[model samples]
Every structure is written in structure tokens, then in C-alpha cells.
Target: MMVNDPNLFWFGCVLWLVIIWLIVSLRHSNKVDSPTESNTAGAREIEELRQECLRLREELQMQSKQLKTDFQNATFSQLQTLLNNYPSVRKMTEAKPDLPAKNLVSLFTSLDNLLASWGYEQIGSAWEQVPYNPQLHQPDTNDIAEGELVYIRFVGYREGSRILSPAKVSRTLPISSPSK
Candidate 1:
């Protein structure tokens, strides 16, 4: 129209250049910031992984403690009868200030029950005079050789094929005599 308006044509060219420059600059800024964005994402992921590891460790510790408690319960629960009578034993002693030896039968019975519950067998009766087998008897003196007659002071205990405690043996029997 009217000689194409030379001033308007120059203005249009400048505006187009500005628009192109803005587009290129915006794309360059985004490209430059891309690595920083990725680094931030990587840091966040690492923190999340650390948190998960801590959670797993805590869970494992809890399970270990629980298993320990369960094992202890299982081990002690074998002597349920003895545990049940333990309180009564204390009360019996308290009730009788002058408690005689024979009145302590309850205590002995509890001990026997405890040993039986653990699958143990008594090696010898108290004051039992038997020919010594070194495997089953522990003599008071080293001079007392095997196959000699010895008396049991306190009965020993054994489990299946394994000896827990060998019978305590002496050369002479006690005055109380053997109580089979």
C-alpha cells in the first residue's frame, strides 16, 4: 500500500528478530538447567534409598529381639511345674521359721521334677554304694582307682548319652545311709 511504509517494514523486521532471539534464549536456558534438575532428582532418590535401608535395618533388629525372647521362653518353659511351685517353696520356708529337714521334701520334689522335665536322668541315688566306674563317678581322691566300691554323696545327672555331671563319690558312705 502507500510505498510499503518503509518505517513500518523496519519495525516489523526488528520485532521478528526479537521474537526469534527470545525463543532461542529460552531453549538455551532450559538446556543449561537440565543437568541441575537431574542432579536434584538423583539426590532425592539417594535419600529415599537411605531411608529404605534404615527401615529394613530397624525391622531386622526387631525380629532378632523377638526371636531371642521366644527362644528364652521356649527354653525356660520346659520346667513349667518347677516354676509353678517356686513361689510356694518360698512361702513354705517363711511360714515355718524352724523348718525341719524333712519338711523340705517339697523342694527336693521340685528339683527332681525340673531335672525330669529337662530330659535328664539321675546317675545314682544319694549315699548309694556301688562299684566305681570312672565314666560315671568322680572320686574324692585320685588314689581311688576305677572298679573300687564308692558311695554317692549327691546324685549326678545325664541326658540321653551325654553326662551333664558325674556322680560325686566318696570312699565311705554317709551316716544317713542310702535312700534309694
Candidate 2:
């Protein structure tokens, strides 16, 4: 009967692989030990091929790293204008004057969508009240205690399980009173 059992199937594969390995190893050793000029030439060719493979592998790795750095630089350059306007954004959150907040909001929504596509997510919404968790929130003052209720003064971001920034938490909201 054919060894159709899954365990036997795997064992059979291992057994065949070991046998093939042994045969190849014996042949390779015999070739290396041969005193013939042709054997020496073949051995030199194999060494050269192995060295080329290593050199190519290292070059590929360097190119990959450079590409990654170039991508990061490009992203930062594109986002520089948005980053420069952060002070205005922070002020808008605090004492919002009769400015074009609607346009700013639309821009922020688009930015949020962009960040979401890049696997970044907001840790907490601006002015959102939540129980204090030191791991996720950075207190504004030393007076703040763990497990206490706090309002997020500034929203933070993260990618997967890694926190990019902790939400800036304060005892009071910067704007009009937020109901508990």
C-alpha cells in the first residue's frame, strides 16, 4: 500500500532528501580530491561563482537601504508645509477665531485619510475625555495621577502596536467647558 498517511509522506520526503544529499556530497568530495587539471579548473570556477553571489547579495542590500532612505526623505519634504502650519492648527484648537476653520477642517480630514492609508491611526481625538493610561497618554502636568480622568489637548498617532506619539492629556480642555 502507498504510504498516503501525512506523517509517512513527510518522513518519505526527508528520507529521499537525505539520500540525495549524501550522493551529491560524495560526488562533490570526489571531484575536489581529483588531481586532474580539469577538476582544478572546475573548483576555481565554483569559488568564483560563490564570491560573485556574495558580492551581488551585498550590493542588493545596499540599494534596498538607499531606496528606503530616499522614500523617507521624499515623504518628509512633501509633508513639510503641513508640519509648518501645526502651530496655527494648535491655536485654532484652543481659541478658534472667526477664520476659515471649515477649509482647515477639510484639509485635516484629508490628512487623516492619508495617514490612515499609511497604517497610522490617531491615539485619541482632540478634547476627548478618557481614563488616564500612562502607556497611551502623556500628562501635561506632574500633578496628574494614574487612572484619573483627563482631556486630550492634542491627538497622537501610532502605526500598528507601535505608538508614534502619546496623546497630550490635560486636566481641562483648552476651549469652552467640556461636559463630563
Candidate 3:
């Protein structure tokens, strides 16, 4: 029973070495788990940001579509009012021609200016004696003879590149001055 028996002391030293090894292994495991947990948290934050971006894009698209719809509805309503006012405004064109040429010239200019104010542009004119064109004019009668545009009652009106309405016209056979 020696207090410093070599076998017993060596056994105690070996036990202490085992205990140190266990503590070091537990510390290393905690370090590894800490990094892995941090990576998982980072990945979760990135996924949340992606979800938020997708939601914002959807909201922007919906707002853009609504704005487009509202604009179209407003344009249509304004166009309806314009069309309703057409007859009164059109009377100016017919009435101006009846005035004296000197007065009518100024009146005609004023009429053109007025039509411009209403978004109309006179593209070209046709004699009341030209051949009928279905593309340019809607014929009241297909049986009517060619070279006989009897009436170019109103000239075609256009806005930008689009025709709002074709000129209303009538056709007839050429007037024969009694061939003598």
C-alpha cells in the first residue's frame, strides 16, 4: 500500500488523459454545430428576401394593369362625347361655303382651325365627279355608274394616322348635255 505506487499513479494519469480527450472532442463538436447552424440561418434569410421580391413584382404588375384599364375607359368616354358633338361642329363646314368668297375664305380658315381643335385633320379632297372607291368611300349604291361622285357632302376626317370617318358621298351617271 505505498502512497506512490507506480502502477496506481500510472492508472490515474491515464484516466486524466481520457477525461481531457473527451472535453476537447465536445468543444470541437460544438464549434462544428455553431457554423452549421449559422449557415442554415443565412439560407433562411435569403429565402425570405426572395419571397418578398416576388410579392412586390406581383403588386406592381397589378397596379400597371389597373392604370391601363382606367385610361382606356376614360378615352372611350371622351370619344363618345366628341362623337355626340359631331353634327353641330360639322354644320360649320357646310354653312361656311354659303358665305361670300372673301368672307368665306376667312370663315373656311376658321373652320379648319376649329376642326383641328377637335383632333381632326383634312387629308385630301375628291371632286364630286371622281370614280367611287370602296376603300375611300362607302357607296350608297353599287349599281351607280363610274366617274360620278355626285356628292362629297363631307370630307373624310382623320386623327393622326387613323381615319375617324370616311366622307359620305353619292354617285350618279355623268350629265350628258344633250349630244347635238
Candidate 4:
């Protein structure tokens, strides 16, 4: 019985050593795994931040493009308003007849230059006579013949295929001769 007791004591010591080794190994492994998990979480957060930044940049670019388009439209609207007012001034000058021809020419030339810069162009010339066509001219009165055209009252303007304004014109009728 004494010899069996010594054997049992050594067996118990070996078993305790194995249990302590296992516990230490498990703790070391847990420490290693915790750092890896934290690193993965950090990488995920960084990726999310990057995606957010890209989305913000795209939004900013879209906003800038919209602003540019709005500014261009506003500028075009102002130019159209200025062009619309020119015909009244031109008519007033014509009525006076005392205004110098050179002054009128200069004013028209400058206006033409401004229009050309903005992709707009005058469609007709003053005193131009052409065969009457309903598509290009608007008649002021219906008293004259249909086929004839006299001096234009106001010139037309166009941009691309769009007509900004139509020409105002009068038609001339041939005078009837007395019976032979």
C-alpha cells in the first residue's frame, strides 16, 4: 500500500502540470487572437471612411456643375433682355430721320458684335427686299398684295434652329394704271 501511494502522488503532480500548461497556452492564444480581431475592425472602419469621402467628393462635383449651368442660363437671360430692348431704340432713331446714318450704323454694328459673341445672329438686313414668305416675316397689315415685299420694319434674330424674334415687314402693292 505504501508503494502504491507514492505512485499515485507522482501521477497527480503530472496531471496538475498538464492542466497549468493548458491554461497558460489558452491565455497566450487569446491575447494573439484579440489583436488580430481589433486590427480587422480598424481596417473595416478605414474602408468605411474612404467610401464616405468618395461619396462626398462626388456630391461636391455635381453641385459645382449645377452652379455653372445655372450661371450660364442667367447670363443668357440677361443678354436676351438687352437684345429685346434694342429694336425700340432703333425705331426711335429711325423716326427722327435727323440722326446721322453713321451713328446708326455704329450702334447696329456693336449690337451685331455682341450678338455674335453669344451664338446669336441677326436674320435680316434693313431695307432688304425679298419674296414674301410667311415662315420668315410677320406682316404689319393686310392691305397689300401677297407676293411683294417692301422694306423691313424690324430685323429678325436667331440662335441655332430657334428663332428669337421674327422680322416685322410691310408689303408693297402695284399701283393700277388708268384704263387705256
Best by lDDT: 2
Expressed as tens digits, the lDDT of each residue in 50-161 for candidate 3 is 5765675576568767876576446534654443334324444344444344343333455456566656664334324455555555556666555555555345656676
In candidate 1, what are the lDDT values of residues 1-180, reduced to their tens digit?
Answer: 464645446645765665576556556656776877756655665566567656755765687678765764565557444443443344444445466633665556766675676676777766567989888888888989788889776666676877756777899854434233
Backbone clash numbers for all candidates listed: 0, 0, 0, 0
Q: Clashes in model 3: which pairs? A: none
Please give the CA lDDT of all the candidate structures: 0.64, 0.66, 0.52, 0.60
RMSD in Å for all candidates: 24.8, 13.1, 26.2, 25.9
Q: Give the C-alpha lDDT of model 2.
A: 0.66
Q: Give the TM-score of candidate 3.
A: 0.32
Q: What's the distance in Å from true for residue 26, model 3? A: 41
lDDT (10s digit) by residue, model 4, range 10-52: 6557656655765565566657768777566556655665676
Work out the TM-score per prediction. Answer: 0.44, 0.54, 0.32, 0.44
lDDT of 2 by residue, 89-129 (tens): 64564455555663565556666566666676677776778
Tell me how candidate 4 scores on lDDT.
Answer: 0.60
Off by over 4 Å in 3: 1-111, 114-119, 126-128, 144-151, 172-180
